[model samples]
Target: MLTELIEIIKDTFLPTIVVTGDTALKTDLALDSFEIINLIGILEDKYKIEINVIDIVSLITLEDICNYIANKKMP
Candidate 1:
Protein backbone atom coordinates (compact mmCIF):
# COMPACT_ATOMS: atom_id res chain seq x y z
CA MET A 1 0.00 0.00 0.00
CA LEU A 2 2.80 2.37 0.85
CA THR A 3 4.48 1.58 -2.43
CA GLU A 4 1.28 2.23 -4.29
CA LEU A 5 0.83 5.54 -2.52
CA ILE A 6 4.37 6.53 -3.40
CA GLU A 7 3.68 5.62 -6.99
CA ILE A 8 0.61 7.79 -7.02
CA ILE A 9 2.52 10.71 -5.58
CA LYS A 10 5.31 10.27 -8.10
CA ASP A 11 2.86 9.94 -10.93
CA THR A 12 1.14 13.11 -9.84
CA PHE A 13 4.17 15.31 -9.26
CA LEU A 14 6.96 13.53 -11.06
CA PRO A 15 9.26 14.18 -8.13
CA THR A 16 12.96 13.72 -8.75
CA ILE A 17 13.85 12.82 -5.17
CA VAL A 18 13.22 9.70 -3.17
CA VAL A 19 9.94 9.57 -1.33
CA THR A 20 9.66 7.90 2.06
CA GLY A 21 7.08 7.50 4.81
CA ASP A 22 8.64 10.35 6.72
CA THR A 23 8.57 12.71 3.74
CA ALA A 24 6.35 15.68 4.41
CA LEU A 25 3.64 16.03 1.82
CA LYS A 26 3.88 19.81 1.71
CA THR A 27 7.54 20.54 2.40
CA ASP A 28 9.25 17.45 0.99
CA LEU A 29 6.86 16.71 -1.83
CA ALA A 30 6.22 20.41 -2.46
CA LEU A 31 2.58 19.69 -3.05
CA ASP A 32 0.62 22.86 -3.50
CA SER A 33 -2.99 23.36 -2.48
CA PHE A 34 -4.33 22.43 -5.88
CA GLU A 35 -2.23 19.29 -6.00
CA ILE A 36 -3.39 18.33 -2.56
CA ILE A 37 -7.00 18.66 -3.67
CA ASN A 38 -6.31 16.60 -6.74
CA LEU A 39 -4.56 13.97 -4.61
CA ILE A 40 -7.60 13.66 -2.38
CA GLY A 41 -9.76 12.90 -5.39
CA ILE A 42 -7.25 10.45 -6.79
CA LEU A 43 -6.95 8.64 -3.49
CA GLU A 44 -10.72 8.44 -3.06
CA ASP A 45 -11.15 6.94 -6.52
CA LYS A 46 -8.20 4.61 -6.21
CA TYR A 47 -9.04 3.39 -2.73
CA LYS A 48 -12.83 3.49 -3.17
CA ILE A 49 -13.20 5.35 0.08
CA GLU A 50 -14.56 8.76 1.00
CA ILE A 51 -11.76 10.96 2.33
CA ASN A 52 -13.16 13.89 4.22
CA VAL A 53 -11.54 17.34 4.19
CA ILE A 54 -10.69 17.06 7.85
CA ASP A 55 -8.91 13.80 7.22
CA ILE A 56 -7.02 15.36 4.33
CA VAL A 57 -5.88 18.22 6.53
CA SER A 58 -4.65 15.79 9.17
CA LEU A 59 -2.34 13.98 6.81
CA ILE A 60 1.20 15.26 7.37
CA THR A 61 3.33 12.52 5.89
CA LEU A 62 3.09 9.85 3.19
CA GLU A 63 2.72 7.22 5.89
CA ASP A 64 -0.32 8.98 7.26
CA ILE A 65 -2.04 8.73 3.90
CA CYS A 66 -1.16 5.05 3.53
CA ASN A 67 -2.46 4.19 6.99
CA TYR A 68 -5.62 6.24 6.51
CA ILE A 69 -6.50 4.48 3.28
CA ALA A 70 -5.65 1.09 4.75
CA ASN A 71 -7.91 1.73 7.71
CA LYS A 72 -10.72 2.99 5.48
CA LYS A 73 -10.70 0.08 3.08
CA MET A 74 -13.72 -2.19 3.22
CA PRO A 75 -13.07 -5.72 4.36
Candidate 2:
Protein backbone atom coordinates (compact mmCIF):
# COMPACT_ATOMS: atom_id res chain seq x y z
CA MET A 1 0.00 0.00 0.00
CA LEU A 2 2.84 2.34 0.79
CA THR A 3 4.46 1.72 -2.58
CA GLU A 4 1.19 2.20 -4.40
CA LEU A 5 0.46 5.39 -2.51
CA ILE A 6 3.88 6.66 -3.40
CA GLU A 7 3.20 5.98 -7.05
CA ILE A 8 -0.13 7.76 -6.94
CA ILE A 9 1.42 10.80 -5.31
CA LYS A 10 4.13 10.77 -7.91
CA ASP A 11 1.78 10.42 -10.84
CA THR A 12 -0.70 12.97 -9.60
CA PHE A 13 1.51 15.71 -8.15
CA LEU A 14 5.21 14.99 -8.39
CA PRO A 15 5.82 13.32 -11.69
CA THR A 16 9.57 13.60 -11.54
CA ILE A 17 10.25 13.47 -7.84
CA VAL A 18 10.77 10.54 -5.50
CA VAL A 19 8.74 10.64 -2.30
CA THR A 20 9.22 8.54 0.79
CA GLY A 21 7.04 7.67 3.74
CA ASP A 22 8.56 10.37 5.93
CA THR A 23 8.30 13.07 3.30
CA ALA A 24 6.12 15.91 4.45
CA LEU A 25 3.30 16.66 2.05
CA LYS A 26 3.55 20.37 2.62
CA THR A 27 7.03 21.05 3.95
CA ASP A 28 8.99 18.66 1.79
CA LEU A 29 6.87 18.61 -1.33
CA ALA A 30 5.57 22.11 -0.89
CA LEU A 31 1.99 21.23 -1.66
CA ASP A 32 -0.23 24.26 -1.47
CA SER A 33 -3.88 24.47 -0.44
CA PHE A 34 -5.16 23.79 -3.93
CA GLU A 35 -2.81 20.89 -4.42
CA ILE A 36 -3.90 19.36 -1.12
CA ILE A 37 -7.52 19.67 -2.22
CA ASN A 38 -6.69 17.96 -5.49
CA LEU A 39 -4.82 15.25 -3.57
CA ILE A 40 -7.88 14.56 -1.45
CA GLY A 41 -9.98 14.13 -4.55
CA ILE A 42 -7.48 11.83 -6.20
CA LEU A 43 -7.12 9.76 -3.04
CA GLU A 44 -10.87 9.36 -2.62
CA ASP A 45 -11.31 8.20 -6.20
CA LYS A 46 -8.35 5.87 -6.15
CA TYR A 47 -9.06 4.35 -2.76
CA LYS A 48 -12.83 4.30 -3.06
CA ILE A 49 -13.22 5.92 0.36
CA GLU A 50 -14.68 9.12 1.70
CA ILE A 51 -12.21 11.45 3.41
CA ASN A 52 -13.52 14.06 5.75
CA VAL A 53 -12.40 17.61 5.12
CA ILE A 54 -11.33 17.89 8.74
CA ASP A 55 -8.82 15.07 8.31
CA ILE A 56 -6.86 17.01 5.75
CA VAL A 57 -4.89 18.82 8.40
CA SER A 58 -3.79 15.53 9.96
CA LEU A 59 -2.33 14.20 6.76
CA ILE A 60 1.10 15.68 7.10
CA THR A 61 3.25 12.87 5.71
CA LEU A 62 3.08 10.09 3.16
CA GLU A 63 2.85 7.54 5.98
CA ASP A 64 -0.06 9.45 7.44
CA ILE A 65 -1.95 9.21 4.18
CA CYS A 66 -1.25 5.49 3.93
CA ASN A 67 -2.47 4.87 7.45
CA TYR A 68 -5.56 7.01 7.00
CA ILE A 69 -6.52 5.25 3.80
CA ALA A 70 -5.78 1.85 5.29
CA ASN A 71 -8.20 2.55 8.11
CA LYS A 72 -10.87 3.97 5.83
CA LYS A 73 -10.68 1.02 3.44
CA MET A 74 -13.00 -1.92 3.98
CA PRO A 75 -11.57 -5.35 4.37
Candidate 3:
Protein backbone atom coordinates (compact mmCIF):
# COMPACT_ATOMS: atom_id res chain seq x y z
CA MET A 1 0.00 0.00 0.00
CA LEU A 2 2.86 2.33 0.82
CA THR A 3 4.45 1.55 -2.52
CA GLU A 4 1.20 2.27 -4.33
CA LEU A 5 0.79 5.56 -2.47
CA ILE A 6 4.30 6.53 -3.49
CA GLU A 7 3.42 5.98 -7.13
CA ILE A 8 0.24 7.96 -6.84
CA ILE A 9 2.08 10.83 -5.17
CA LYS A 10 4.81 10.76 -7.76
CA ASP A 11 2.44 10.59 -10.71
CA THR A 12 0.08 13.18 -9.32
CA PHE A 13 2.32 15.48 -7.29
CA LEU A 14 6.04 15.02 -7.89
CA PRO A 15 7.51 13.10 -10.77
CA THR A 16 11.04 14.37 -10.44
CA ILE A 17 11.58 13.05 -6.95
CA VAL A 18 11.64 9.50 -5.64
CA VAL A 19 9.41 9.11 -2.60
CA THR A 20 10.11 6.70 0.23
CA GLY A 21 8.49 6.04 3.59
CA ASP A 22 10.82 8.46 5.33
CA THR A 23 10.32 11.21 2.78
CA ALA A 24 9.16 14.43 4.36
CA LEU A 25 6.01 15.57 2.65
CA LYS A 26 6.90 19.17 3.37
CA THR A 27 10.67 19.59 3.28
CA ASP A 28 11.47 16.77 0.88
CA LEU A 29 8.63 17.36 -1.52
CA ALA A 30 8.14 21.02 -0.75
CA LEU A 31 4.39 20.73 -1.14
CA ASP A 32 2.57 23.96 -0.61
CA SER A 33 -0.74 24.40 1.17
CA PHE A 34 -2.97 23.65 -1.79
CA GLU A 35 -0.99 20.61 -2.81
CA ILE A 36 -1.19 19.24 0.69
CA ILE A 37 -4.96 19.62 0.68
CA ASN A 38 -5.22 17.95 -2.69
CA LEU A 39 -2.96 15.16 -1.53
CA ILE A 40 -5.18 14.59 1.51
CA GLY A 41 -8.19 14.32 -0.72
CA ILE A 42 -6.48 11.85 -3.00
CA LEU A 43 -5.33 9.76 -0.08
CA GLU A 44 -8.78 9.68 1.46
CA ASP A 45 -10.33 8.67 -1.83
CA LYS A 46 -7.75 6.05 -2.67
CA TYR A 47 -7.68 4.49 0.76
CA LYS A 48 -11.39 4.96 1.48
CA ILE A 49 -10.81 6.69 4.76
CA GLU A 50 -11.70 10.00 6.32
CA ILE A 51 -8.98 12.27 7.65
CA ASN A 52 -9.79 15.09 9.96
CA VAL A 53 -8.46 18.53 9.15
CA ILE A 54 -6.50 18.61 12.39
CA ASP A 55 -4.88 15.27 11.70
CA ILE A 56 -3.54 16.56 8.43
CA VAL A 57 -0.92 18.52 10.29
CA SER A 58 0.34 15.37 11.96
CA LEU A 59 0.90 13.61 8.65
CA ILE A 60 4.31 15.01 7.85
CA THR A 61 5.89 11.98 6.20
CA LEU A 62 5.09 9.15 3.84
CA GLU A 63 5.34 6.74 6.74
CA ASP A 64 2.79 8.82 8.61
CA ILE A 65 0.34 8.59 5.76
CA CYS A 66 0.90 4.86 5.43
CA ASN A 67 0.35 4.36 9.13
CA TYR A 68 -2.80 6.45 9.06
CA ILE A 69 -4.20 4.35 6.23
CA ALA A 70 -3.20 1.14 7.93
CA ASN A 71 -4.90 2.14 11.15
CA LYS A 72 -8.02 3.29 9.35
CA LYS A 73 -8.19 -0.06 7.54
CA MET A 74 -8.19 -1.98 10.79
CA PRO A 75 -11.47 -3.61 11.71
Candidate 4:
Protein backbone atom coordinates (compact mmCIF):
# COMPACT_ATOMS: atom_id res chain seq x y z
CA MET A 1 0.00 0.00 0.00
CA LEU A 2 2.81 2.35 0.89
CA THR A 3 4.59 1.55 -2.32
CA GLU A 4 1.39 2.17 -4.26
CA LEU A 5 0.93 5.48 -2.50
CA ILE A 6 4.50 6.44 -3.33
CA GLU A 7 3.91 5.58 -6.93
CA ILE A 8 0.77 7.70 -7.03
CA ILE A 9 2.58 10.63 -5.47
CA LYS A 10 5.51 10.26 -7.81
CA ASP A 11 3.26 10.12 -10.80
CA THR A 12 1.26 13.07 -9.63
CA PHE A 13 4.07 15.39 -8.54
CA LEU A 14 6.92 14.10 -10.64
CA PRO A 15 9.36 14.93 -7.89
CA THR A 16 13.00 15.04 -8.91
CA ILE A 17 14.08 13.98 -5.43
CA VAL A 18 13.58 10.71 -3.61
CA VAL A 19 10.58 10.39 -1.35
CA THR A 20 10.32 8.44 1.88
CA GLY A 21 7.66 7.66 4.46
CA ASP A 22 9.11 10.28 6.77
CA THR A 23 9.04 12.98 4.11
CA ALA A 24 6.93 16.00 4.94
CA LEU A 25 4.06 16.34 2.49
CA LYS A 26 4.08 20.09 2.14
CA THR A 27 7.73 20.90 2.59
CA ASP A 28 9.20 17.96 0.70
CA LEU A 29 6.51 17.10 -1.81
CA ALA A 30 5.46 20.69 -2.30
CA LEU A 31 1.89 19.66 -2.80
CA ASP A 32 -0.49 22.55 -3.17
CA SER A 33 -4.14 22.57 -2.11
CA PHE A 34 -5.34 21.42 -5.52
CA GLU A 35 -2.81 18.64 -5.61
CA ILE A 36 -3.81 17.55 -2.13
CA ILE A 37 -7.44 17.38 -3.25
CA ASN A 38 -6.38 15.38 -6.27
CA LEU A 39 -4.43 13.02 -4.03
CA ILE A 40 -7.43 12.48 -1.78
CA GLY A 41 -9.62 11.76 -4.78
CA ILE A 42 -7.11 9.27 -6.14
CA LEU A 43 -6.75 7.60 -2.78
CA GLU A 44 -10.49 7.30 -2.33
CA ASP A 45 -10.87 5.76 -5.75
CA LYS A 46 -7.96 3.41 -5.22
CA TYR A 47 -8.84 2.36 -1.67
CA LYS A 48 -12.63 2.52 -1.98
CA ILE A 49 -12.90 4.50 1.22
CA GLU A 50 -14.12 7.95 2.08
CA ILE A 51 -11.55 10.42 3.35
CA ASN A 52 -12.68 13.72 4.76
CA VAL A 53 -10.94 17.05 4.51
CA ILE A 54 -10.25 17.09 8.24
CA ASP A 55 -8.54 13.73 7.99
CA ILE A 56 -6.43 14.96 5.12
CA VAL A 57 -5.52 18.15 6.98
CA SER A 58 -4.35 16.09 9.93
CA LEU A 59 -1.91 14.11 7.86
CA ILE A 60 1.62 15.42 8.42
CA THR A 61 3.80 12.95 6.57
CA LEU A 62 3.70 10.24 3.95
CA GLU A 63 3.66 7.66 6.73
CA ASP A 64 0.62 9.33 8.21
CA ILE A 65 -1.27 8.95 4.94
CA CYS A 66 -0.18 5.33 4.60
CA ASN A 67 -1.21 4.53 8.16
CA TYR A 68 -4.53 6.27 7.66
CA ILE A 69 -5.32 4.12 4.66
CA ALA A 70 -4.16 0.97 6.42
CA ASN A 71 -6.35 1.68 9.39
CA LYS A 72 -9.33 2.41 7.15
CA LYS A 73 -8.85 -0.92 5.44
CA MET A 74 -9.19 -2.64 8.80
CA PRO A 75 -12.54 -4.05 9.85
Over 4 Å off in model 2, which ranges?
none
Model 3 global lDDT (CA atoms, 0 to 1): 0.90
> What is the lDDT for 5 in model 3?
83
Per-residue lDDT for 37-60 in model 2, tens only?
Answer: 998898899888999999999999
TM-score order, best first, reads 3, 4, 1, 2
lDDT by residue (tens digit), candidate 4, 4-45: 888888888864668889977788888888988988999999
The CA lDDT at 5 in model 2 is 81
> In model 2, how large is the Cα lDDT of residue 66?
92
Please provide TM-scores, in order, for all candidate models, with all chains considered together: 0.91, 0.91, 0.94, 0.92
Q: Backbone clash tally for model 3? A: 0
lDDT of 2: 0.90
**Worst 10-residue lDDT window, candidate 3:** 11-20
lDDT per residue as tens, model 3, 1-75: 889989988999888888899998889999998999998999888878999999999999999999988998999
lDDT values for all models? 0.88, 0.90, 0.90, 0.87
Instruction: Note the residue pairs that clash in candidate 1.
Output: none
- Deviation in Å, model 3, residue 1 alpha carbon: 1.1
Q: Where's the lowest-lDDT run of ten residues in candidate 2?
A: 5-14
Which scores higher on TM-score, 2 or 3? 3
Q: After superposition, how far is residue 75 of candidate 3 from its true place, in Å?
A: 1.2
Candidate 1: regions farther than 4 A off: none
